[model samples]
Target chain A: MAEFDKNMDFPELDAYFSKTSEAADDRMALLELLKRGAVAYRGTEELRKKCLNARELLPKEYRYLEFAGLQKLIEKCKIFDLKNYSRELIKCIIIGVCYYTLFQSIAASAVIFILCLIVMVGGGYMTHRKNAKKLETYYNLAVELRGVFPELELEEDYCSEEKLMSLYDIVQANELTSLESAVVKLKAIG
Target chain B: MGKEIQWLSFKTREQKQADLDEYTRWVFKYGQPQKEKVEQILSRLFPKEAPSMAMMTYLLGRDAYYGRYNTKKSSDRNPIKDMYDVLSKKRYQVPKKDIPLYMALIIADERVSEALDYPPDDVLHVVAARLMEQE
Candidate 1:
């Protein structure tokens, strides 16, 4: 399928649609995935609002970088996890614990390390890193925004801390496929 | 109270409150720390649980400038709210419905100035509002 290979940007999302069956089980699974995406999309909207508010209030020193990071996050929020590589992720974690347990045996530990790497790499750990990088840029931008109002934040009732920290955590804690779920949810809703 | 009269009064009060809220939201938004500072001082000066009325907004505009224009010479308190107790006086009582527009004029007036305590100048949206207000 040369045509399919050319068009499929997200191989993980492709896995979901590759199945031929329109069976109830598959339909339910898609719905569940879409629901996760919807939740992630809401998170994305909150982040976008923070970006806009900070962009407005603060000087433009970090505007380009902040906006760029925010743009990547917005895009990611639309495409995160679609293949459900969570099982593989869990396996990698288990193997990691075992690898540590057997680290005294260098040869065996190296083999285990290789296995873990293969599993993690296959499970879209690269995508996680890409997303994490985007999140770091946004966090840096937020720091710049916070720098603008150092004294104001010291007040007890100010909500800026909540806005910065909660949004950063939302971006950081989201699953790799969180955006994919959001895209599917939007499509289903539409 | 009669049902019709009570309902009308309630509606009027709600509409007035909504207008005040909208006006304050605008000031808070564009005015930045100056407006926020004014709000903080006013909230402290009043320290009442009563719902916001036009007097509070008017007092903030009338006082809270850098210096002068106050009965008190202490130099710390907002003159309009602290010296005059403008809200307590009956003549200064702005009609409920007119509070928002009235306060807008006061906050945005050319004579009023934002305190220079914070940096970057132009804390109050006075110049912007004056230009927009064409005054």
Candidate 2:
């Protein structure tokens, strides 16, 4: 069995396959696609046929499981990528060190804590602002629809008991929050 | 060789519709009143524009999952159980301290609902429980 190299890029894989394995890049690409869930295994006769046909196009030794092994490597690289974890760990350590240093000086610690709090609050506020904009967009779209369909009387006649009940049903079924339920209610009313 | 991958069958159109219908009925029974309360909160939060109800519903659902539902752990040290410790102490009056958490929960719920395609009513119950639990 070939040892899987985590550090190897696509080009490296291609080179290795071309030199050692008999399978061409096309077979590799198909396997890669399937591994990514871009193509479904079942009910995909065309793809299955393509893979089968392509197998003959390649060397017999560099067939089925070899192709599957490469696909699994591709998936493993995607799933267990340590970059995000490494970055987060580094950030936590840096923050911990900074806090420790700040604690050495009580005045500095207070300032640092306040600064961190401000940053967190500001970030939260910014997020809320973004949500507000989304709400505005939805509101504007509703208003525009009302303007276009004035005869329908969207705001007034839009929310029938049946519609409200139905919307309520959707909220309950999904087990949504009060705010979520309200939003559905408003949509039904509109 | 590893275990063979088994592809689950997709739901039939009729089955999907029936599920949707059942879900909708449950939501109506449980979700409507909670929605009213959320609307009141939203109106207070954003006095300028009439807040989008759809967005609110979506947010509420998301928060219910992320904040409350997702926190459920099999271990004894469950953070969800001690939710009241972090919630507002004031029983009747909505304390200024608690409002932020409430608002945050609402926003979180919306995102979860949108991502999961959850029904609004289920989200509402979760939100109500989180809110009332604080009291």
Q: Which stretches of candidate 2 lie above 4 Å from their native place?
A: A1-190, B1-9, B21-34, B47-135
Instruction: Tell how far residue A122 is off in model 2, in angstroms.
Output: 93
Q: What TM-score does each of the candidates earn? A: 0.18, 0.19
lDDT of candidate 2 over B1-135, digit per residue (tens): 012233553777897689667654443333655556456555554455446843343343433323433444535332322332323234423444434344344433333321232223434445444444444
Listed models, DockQ each: 0.01, 0.01
lDDT of each: 0.42, 0.41
Q: Which ten residues in a row have the lowest lDDT in candidate 1 chain A?
A: A1-10
Best by TM-score: 2
Candidate 1 has which clashing residue pairs, if any?
A: A37-A181, A37-A182, A77-A179, A79-A179, A79-A180, A80-A177, A80-A179, A80-A180, A81-A177, A81-A178
- Model 1 CAPRI rating: incorrect
